[model samples]
Structure formats: structure tokens, C-alpha cells
Target chain A: MEPRPTAVRPPIHLRIADDIRMQIERGELPPGAAIPTLAEISERWSCGMNSARGAVALLRAQGLITSGRGKAPVVRIPPRRVIRSSERHQIEKDLALKPEAERGAIGEAETNLNMSIGAQRFSSQYDQVEAGPELAKVFGVEPTTLMLRRQWEATDPNTELRLSWSVSHIPLDIVKSNPALLDPNNEPWPGGTQHQLSTVGVEIMKMVDEVTARMPTTVEAQLWGLPEGVPLIFCRRISIDGDGRVIETSDADYPADRTELHFVTPLRPWPKRRQA
Target chain B: MEPRPTAVRPPIHLRIADDIRMQIERGELPPGAAIPTLAEISERWSCGMNSARGAVALLRAQGLITSGRGKAPVVRIPPRRVIRSSERHQIEKDLALKPEAERGAIGEAETNLNMSIGAQRFSSQYDQVEAGPELAKVFGVEPTTLMLRRQWEATDPNTELRLSWSVSHIPLDIVKSNPALLDPNNEPWPGGTQHQLSTVGVEIMKMVDEVTARMPTTVEAQLWGLPEGVPLIFCRRISIDGDGRVIETSDADYPADRTELHFVTPLRPWPKRRQA
Candidate 1:
């Protein structure tokens, strides 16, 4: 279909922004290089200073450039993010019987190395609640049954804004066997969820992560210290045991700019073909 | 770590905004319900009108509420998005051999149900370029060899903003056997990419989608009409043929609020134990 006439006339600022963006992508203006000032762009592009400023603003919003009050805009060099692959599930399962020192030395949690927890305010809330229809289906239990919900959050000490957050749900009946599981102080469970489940006779044989993305609420944005145009990655991980029972469901969110989720699928070798 | 007090306490508006946000999450105010007016909020919360207005503005920017002139802000209900599963690769392969009429009836484009192609401006550009070092490694071809790069975008009819964007790359030599493959007009090709490649004796045996999320820059926010704190989902899909040769690479971007990606992994049945 032909485009609507209203969409045909690209705005002046957008056209200007696209030109500068192309130059950056083509490496004519390299990362960390200062872009032309509004006055310079106005003179070169025969546009008003406001239009030039708008172009710069547009570029900054797209994360192509960075600028502060009274500072010239410059191309941004994004930091490298570590990839946390789902394949780690298999590795964690194999490490269940290993000593704590050996497990700690693996350095899996420290691998990506984005934010440091030491500089944040951490909180954990533990509560028992009836499972909703969604959780009940996953847990293979009645909706009225009580489930344990643990919420964890870390706020930036300086801004008092949220840095990270996650919530995990487990059947109350299973984890109640160990009273420590209900204690908020017992968090950061040394070996992570795998070890926590092992204490409850749950051997997780498989895990599936469903991933999506969405705009954060106003309160969420402030907590995450997110910039404009950035989205949050939402993942729901379902863990199943050897008996095929769903053991737990954990939901986590990551800021898109600083998080990369990787999934590695190792294929089984095809059976050898019979000789003709 | 404890949160440090701010030198200038955040304005009352921010505190009020946070409180209202909590109310929404607690189910006091449900999605799609009208938010209280500035006057009402100011009176109820014992805050100034400016603070109330600021809180509403913050909610709108965060995508929690939607409003316009003369319209009171209402809680936003995110639209339901279609989940595109990777397991469809095998299904698509089987459908490729069907008659063109049957294939056209099945329509692969239906996957994007919430995004209407007719409501936006569409653009597609095709170019022949030498494979860069990274792409050359995947294609197992010389860097000097030509590759076809295709970029597509849909812009909103009213705002002239980006709605959907993607780019695909294929070795020119592999697809050039069919001249039509070079034409952008043939997009939404019956049976999708697999069928298009089949014309050249290329059968995609496997496909992998690498997914990540990040915040968008200022310009991207405007283009996608993303609210503050929204993240974008980035996915790179790699297609490999029976010979284990990478045939095509396609990258797609989806607005976080309206995209869900599903992946299914089928496990092989365990081999029978050897007779004792």
C-alpha cells in the first residue's frame, strides 16, 4: 500500500538527525568524537538553531550521543555487557555436590560484572500467599493452596533508586520442611536456587526461560534509574524436576542496555545412517 | 548499605507519584481506569496542584497512563502480543512444498497480528556489499565476496515514527540464482524466507534466535513512541542449511511493551538400557 501523505514529509529535525546518524554509522564521526554544535549545524544545514538542537536531542535519546548541561554532544561508546546463557543450568546441576569453595571459585555470578551489590541497599520480603490460577497451573496445585513468595530488591545507596529486583515463588508445603527457607535473612542462598531446592528433595532436571520486554511503570523507571527509550527485559523461568513436577517459578527483569541473555542449545548427533 | 539522604529532598510531586503508583499495583486503581484529576489528587493527598500535575505527567511519561488535552489520564492496559515460537521452523519447512495458493492462504505475515502493515509507511532497501570480517566468518566465505543486505521499516502514518524495523543479510551468490530474490517487491514472499531460499536449493535446517534487551536512545524513543523507561528487545536470527553452512542472518527489533518471543526445545527420548 502507498504510504499516507501525512507520513511522507519527514520532519526537518528527523531528516537532520538521520543525516548525522548516517555519518556516525559510516564512521565519518567516530565514537567519543564531538558532534557539531547547534550553531554549526544550523549554518551547515541551513536550518534554525532549534532544529539543530532538536536533532542533537533526538540523537541523544537514541543513545547515539551523550551530552550534559553546557557540554557538547559526543558519540557514545556503549560498554560491553556479559552474556548469561541458559546453558548454565546444566553446569549448576553438575556442581550441586561440589564443595562451597569449589562452587564459589567458578565465578559464574561475577562473570558479567555490571553492577556491584556492595554499594546498594538490599531488602528481602517473605510472605505466604494463595497461588493464583497462573501459578497453580505451573505448580500443578490448587489455586487455594498457599505458596511462598520472596521478593528481593537492591536500591542504589546514593539515589535511593532500585538497581535490581526479582521475585520467586515456591510451594509452601515443600519448602516448609526447612524453616530456614521461610526466613528472609537466609537469602543470597550460597549455591543459588539449585542448592535451595536440593535441600527440599527437589532435583531440577530442566529449566525453561520465557523472555519478553515491556515499558516500565513510572515508579519502576525511577527505581531502575533508566534513561528515556530504554526497555526492561522480562523473563519467567520455570524449573521442573525429575518427576516432571514444576518445582519453582522465578521472574526477573533486566535493563536492556546493560543485560544480554544467551541460550545455547547443543544438538544431539544424528544416528549413523545404515550402509546401503 | 543504607540509602543516603539527598541534599535536596526529591520534590513532593515525586513522593506523591510513588504513592499513587503503589496504589495502582495494590489494585486500588486498576488498569484502564481514570486517574484522579489534579484538583482531586491535590485535595485527597493534601498536596499542591502543581505537584499533582507533575505526578500525572510522570505517570504518562512512564507509560503507566495515557491522556491528552481535556482528557483525564487513565491507567494504560498493555495490548496482548502474539508469541512467535522458534519451533515453527520445522512446521514452515514442511509447508514450503505446498502449492503457492495454499501457502499464500496460510500467510506467514499473520504472526504480526497487532502490527498492521497498511497503517504505516513501509520502506525496503536492497544493497550488495562485501561481507565484513564478522559476517565472513559465519558465511565461511571470503570477505571480498558480495552479500545482499536488505533493510525494512514501517513508520506510523500520523507521527512519521518508526513502528517496526528489521534487516536481513544473505550471500548474493547463494540467492542470485533467482533474480527475483534481489527485488524488494517480492517481500512477504509466499512461504517466507525458507521458500525463497528453496528456489535456490537452500533448505534451512536449523534456526537460532539470540535475544537481548536494552534502553533506547532519545531518538529511538520518539521513533517508537516509547515511554520513558521502556526497553527494546533485540534479536538476531541465524539460519543454517543441511550442510551446516550459515545461509542467512536477520536482525529484528520489537518494542518491549508489545512483543513476546517464545522458544521450544524438544528433548530426545532416552535410549533403552543395554540387556544385562
Candidate 2:
């Protein structure tokens, strides 16, 4: 009896996907370039249409391409990550005394160091809600006290993909000193949050940042265009005033793979007697 | 020109997926419980086989389910995050002279407190490699000098999912004082890395942690079992000895969704002036 032929091992779908991946990496499939149709892929790879479709799905999962109902898959070009460092805490504190142009140049919102205003859509929402238990504890306020909640998000208009997101909360009584603080139109606030609080006579003497990370949900993944195995960075910034009263709290999420969080900690000199 | 009945808006696939998601959240599908098979799902949801398959795939991508060839998908149980804080630096420094059992309970690895040993697999690899240019500058060593490298990882054995991961590097010449330090078997060393360096006549006077976050790639997402929209927390820790010489550097990654990075910065009181 003739020995059964070994199963033909090289999966056609994987081979096709590899070829496209290589092309993308080599710049043959530049960002925004249309990917081949299922029929075209099948003919090019000499494989079944299902195999071609599978290859396209593989590429999409790898964040190499994107597809929709009427559109062909296209190479995905991710935006540059913005670096928000804890070192900037001190820098922002110092910059508060500077002129508008100077402060704007060194602003926290100026995450783009190259000074290029890339094409991105930004939206800010403002609302007044009672602080939740967790947030109340951080802000040293009653859970029922009204607080101003501001949420901001920037998206890539072409893909409707989120680029950056953050939420800030301040006790209404604290920011009511400057009614402008309650307006979303006043966003992109010059000098950022610190300056906004300053207008209300709140001086943030100290800032503490708590950070953590976790996996994203399916819906979140689509919003951020995140690939599997990547975690999200969660940061909560707590600000305190001169009397050790918690004044403001803000929480933000960042994609871990592309973003870099920097923290600068300065140490005091050891006592002369204790020096070795 | 009837607008084609609005294209029959609803799809069988989305309906099936949403129903399963609701079931999972409602605890009908408990952690580790097998998810319905494509055939079963097709019958239960009154959808086609392909739609059933799509539903399962959606759940897997959301991190709610895990599947393998020939096996039914199962609900995924989220793992508890171990909290490793910068405060461990001061804790270890103060506990150096304490007894073994006491020291072990308070050192760096103590963060694994609530974790089940059987649920997670821990591995450490030790190697000696030449210091790269970037590391050489920080360690004040020549690029040609060998440096000891230790990598630690904790993963879910069944799913092969990473829970925690970190890498530490030290100049070989500095740690060579204790031969046991070169052995991977000596890991989980009592008193942690600080004590290990002490055996080599190195005294860490300061430590710095730099942190950031970004989106994860496809490969990274799978390894960490991350969902979409999640960010990753990146931390690089540098240790400096008495002479302000950089002695060790370690890098760690954390999933932002489930992990929290806490840093405590201690401030010293201002010096009192002597009476004239």
C-alpha cells in the first residue's frame, strides 16, 4: 500500500498574510494604500477566496491594515505618542509666572514637541455631578457635593480613532470663583489645569500621581485601535493646597505601547554629619 | 427607490455576540466555565454557524473568553495585580538587618501576597552580556564590560498569559563578589536586590523610577491577554550607590487596567538655624 501523503503543511492563508506584512514593513504598502480585494488576493496567491479573506483578517488583527464595508483594507499608520512626564509638574508650576506666549510654549497641552499641529479632532464636555465615594475620598469632599467634571478626547478624523483622552474633576465651590471654569468653550485652557485652578485662587502646593495598568475591553480596543496583549496605563493626579486640603483630581488613560511616562524625583542632600 | 428597507439593519452575528456578552456579565457563564460551542450557540441564538463563530471570536478578543483548537471557549478569570511600589526601596533599606522570615515578608516580592502560587508560573533567567552604549552611560562603565542580567516573569500556566514581568541588570564586576549571585537558583533571594548588592560591598544610596504608558502591539497584546483601549505602564528603575555611581537598572511592564503604580516621595524638614 502506498504511504499516505503527508498533509500539505504551509497554510495558504498564513503565506499570503506574511507576504502582505512584509510588503507593509518594506513600505511597498504605504499607509492609506488600498489593500487587494479578496478576489485579487486569491488570484495573486493562487489560493481560495476564504484563504485570501483570512489573510486580510490576520493583517487587520496585527494593526497593519484596516477595512470596512465599502472600503478595501489599508495599511494603518499610528500617530506619534505624546510624552507626559511628572517632571512637568514642577515645570508647569514654575511656568505659571511667565507670560502667556512663554507659558503656552511650555504648556502641558503642547505635547507635540515638534510644534506641528497634526490633523486631529478634539472635543471637551463639561458637567456638574456629585463626586463618587472613591473620588470624594481623594478630594476630601462630601460624596454629595457637586463637582465639575470635564472630559476631553482627541480623535483621528480620517479613521474616527481616539488619539488621547482624559477627565478632570474639581469641586464646584472651588472653581465657582471663576465661572469661566464651568464652560467647555474655555477649554484648551492656557496653562492647563493648574492655571485654571489658579484663576479660582486655588494654589496646588503638591501633586501626587497614582499609576496602574490593565487590559482593555473589546469596545475600548476599537476606540484606541489597540492590539491584543497590550495594557492601558491609568494615572490619577491628585492636587493639594497649602492647608493639605485636596483641591482637584484628574484621571487619564494612555496606551502603554506607544506612550512614555516620565517622573522626576529630586532628593535633598544628606546631612553633613551623616555624609560618609 | 425605497432605500432598500434600510439594508435590513440588524445582523445575526452582532445579536449573538451581544447576547453572549450579556450572559457572561450576568454570571451565567462563570469564570473557567466552558462557553457554548458554535453548533450550540447557533441553535441557542437562532443564528447561522458562521455567525456563531463570529460571536465566539468577538468574546475572545474582548478578553472574556479563551479558546484553543478542538476545545470549547471558556470564560477568562482576571488575575489579581501585584502592587510593587517605590516605597519598597525604603522598606528594604530599613529591613536589611532583620531576620530571614521577617525580611522575606517585607521585601520587594512581598507584593505577591494574595496571589495563588498554583495559578501562576514564575520563571527567572540569568545571563551576562556586554553593557550596551545606553546602559554604559548610566552605569558609568565601558560598553565592553559584562553586566549581569536577570529577567522575571509570572504567567497563568493554563492560558500562558503573562501576569507580571521585569528585567534587572547589574555590572558583573560589582556583583561578582558573591558567586551565588550569579546563579539563577538563588532568585527570590531574601531581602531582594538591595541585599544582593550589599553582599558585593555596594550600598545603594538612592533609587529613581521613570514611568510612562502607550498602546500595545498585536503580539504584546496576546502575550498579556490585553483587551483593546487598554494602555501599558512602563517603568525604568535606576539604583545609585554611596558614591552616586549607578549600580543597577531594571525595567518592568504592567498592564494598566489591572495594575496600579504607586510612588511615595518623602520630604525632609528644613534645617533649623543655630543660635548666634
- Number of the top TM-score candidate: 1
| Model 1 TM-score, all chains together | 0.77
- Ten-residue region with minimum lDDT total, candidate 2 chain A: A267-276
Worst 10 residues of 2 chain B by lDDT: B267-276
Per-residue CA lDDT of model 1 for B112-222, tens digit only, reads: 545565565778899999998888887899998899999988776677778678889999989998999999888767777777887897767677677887656546766
**lDDT for A255 (candidate 1):** 71
Per-model TM values vs. the true structure: 0.77, 0.68
lDDT of 2 by residue, A137-241 (tens): 887778999998999888876667677788888889988978888888876676777677666666667777788765565556668877644456777888777
The Cα local distance difference test for each model comes to 0.74, 0.72
Looking at candidate 1 chain A, the ten consecutive residues that score lowest on lDDT are A267-276
In the order shown, the candidates' Cα RMSDs to the true structure are: 5.5, 8.0
lDDT of 2 at B247: 88
